[model samples]
Target: MSWYNTSARQLPWRDPGTDPWAILVCEVMSQQTPIARVLPAWEEWMARWPDPTALAEASPAHVIIAWGTLGYPRRALRLQECAGVVVEKWDGTLPRSREDLLSLPGIGPYTADAIIAFAYRERTTVLDVNVRRVLARIYGEAAPPTSLKAWEVERASHLVPDDGEAASQWNAAIMELGALICTARNPRCEQCPIAPHCAWLKLGKPEAATPRKVQAFEGTHRQARGKVMRVLRTAHAPIGVEELRERSGLPEVRFEPALTTLLADGLAAATPGGIQLPIE
Candidate 1:
């Protein structure tokens, strides 16, 4: 089937008229977050900020709070920073070029390409985990994409329709195919639109030798850091070291490491009383 013949889910940002700022917001929010969770947040954000200028003018603390419950609150700061750059540098516009978007704070290759293709309706290869999985399955590759290979982009670029409107639809359709059917876990292959052409399906889906790496969460320094940040994110004033120690439930030694990590990562800042979100 042609890429367009495969029906896909309709996403707000996939619409041709979606503003670049809104598309950028979706990209950041969707990082490490499921689409189900990001939709409501995106709606609220668009309703509140509407554009780069509005987000740039808002306090970082307000942005963090508004970002509500999206883990990795530091992204909020980087997003605010990105908005400021977009408004100040781009004259209140998001740059359409991939290189220019990549130059923005917190925007990496995937995000840059995503904004260009989805928001600006540019014909560019947009690769994310889902797209990678779909590509791998279609090619019957054993390994998932380790790095952004030149061929991968070229292949995706070829699939994009030459016409602007169809190209946008193809972009969204491919992504929706990846998310709903060609999933990493518990994929619903029977319902996939492109199952007939799937090389993995033809060859019998083979398991990869190495399982995907999973990050250790519990009992790690990240957990301790999260505990510390959770306390500070909720606190109205800067907290002291002693209070952080008590709240994070980490040893005195671990507390130092956690605070240091947070500070180094721009997730937290040192204060006279204790520590706080960089807002202070």
Candidate 2:
């Protein structure tokens, strides 16, 4: 906590006056995306849609365009869907309960806990990849499991402070510690405040029995989809499907499935003229 108080990054959403909606946006944008990349995008997004009402009313085309290079464009649409639900069902106010938050689109366990802890300042185990790694090392595991376990959740829950404010700070501090010091690769243990207490250090830092798998991006269908979406996002008007595919510069095999999935996912639409981003 002491280290976090002085060394935590000055993220805009961490500001004292930031509201729950802004925190929700930050959490969504930060998922699988680096904080550096998310920072500018998040700022522009919040400025464009400061509240649920604003986001709910935003056009799908505008939302996808504003989402820019954030790899998982579907999350952007899900966020808009969440905002719509918040507006229509909750009177434009984010719900305080975990169950209620989980009911919102794109929100899962980690996000729900985060909103509870960071937004509402509640006592909840807010587990993310960083926090999970930090806890795994502290307890002598070389790495966290491929998927979260019941035991992990129970252990993390027990570690939370009883008081809401203290618990929130603990959650933030531990997550920051993991992000900055106890990183997944080449951890800076010498400067870590919890280095003295970390069990993995005492155990000689054994490697994980199974190394994590890294997915390849080049030439993947996902990459092709991104290329297609980029063209559609920048287009002022619909373009013919074949023209759009040629413009994407993807081979026919990659382009066909990419376009099919984009249209199926509702990320793009086929208009009377041609294909473009969803205007609705």
Candidate 3:
């Protein structure tokens, strides 16, 4: 907590008065996307839709277009769905309990726990990949990163401070530590706050027994999907199939599967003339 007070990044989402909805947006946008990009989009999103009710009332195409180049366009659709639930079911007030938050579209264990801890001021564990790595390196003899046995929630639940304030700070601190110093590649051990007691350091930092594999992003369905979403984001009207193909830089390839996926995910819509983002 002391380290966090002195070193935490000055982010809009960390503002003392940031509301639950904004926090939820930040968490969702930050998933598999850099905070640098998430920041601008979040600001615009909040400016346009200050609450769940506003977001729920917006057109899906507007939301997707506003989501911009954040890659996973489906997250925008899910976020909109989540907003609708919050507005319709919870009256625009985000749930205070983990179970209810988890019941919302796109809300999962980690997100639910974060809402509980950060927004609700309850003692709860937040276990992102960074937190996972930090914990695995710290109390590792008992639970190494390699040991594929148990669950993160169960393990992380035990480490949080009993008090709400300290617990939230601890969650943020550990995650920041991992992201800034204890990085996946070339950790800055000297700058680490807990370096003196880090088990990985003591053990000379052995390589992973089975290294994690990196998935290809380029030349994959994800790339094609992103391409399609990008086209829709910039279009003023529904784009024809041929136009979509030409704009997508894949004129020879048929994107029927991608279009179907976009429709199913509620990220796009079909029109008589062409395909477009969902109508309001």
Q: What is the C-alpha lDDT of each candidate?
A: 0.81, 0.95, 0.84
Q: Candidate 1 local accuracy as lDDT?
A: 0.81
Give stretches of model 3 more than 4 Å off.
141-151, 251-254
Q: Kindly list the per-residue Cα lDDT of model 2 for residues 146-178, writing each as its tens digit.
A: 999999999999989999999999999999998
Residue range with the least summed lDDT across 10 consecutive positions in model 3 = 140-149
lDDT of 1 by residue, 17-115 (tens): 778889889999999999889999999989999998999998776787777777777788899899899889999899988889889999998898788
Top-lDDT candidate index: 2
Higher-TM-score candidate of 1 and 3: 3
Give the TM-score (vs. native) of candidate 1: 0.91
Question: Model 1: which residue pairs collide?
Answer: 239-274, 240-274
For model 3, how does the per-residue alpha-carbon lDDT over 224-256 read when each residue is reduced to its tens digit?
888888888888888888888788885455476
Worst 10 residues of 1 by lDDT: 1-10
For candidate 2, what is the lDDT?
Answer: 0.95
**By lDDT: ranked, best first:** 2, 3, 1
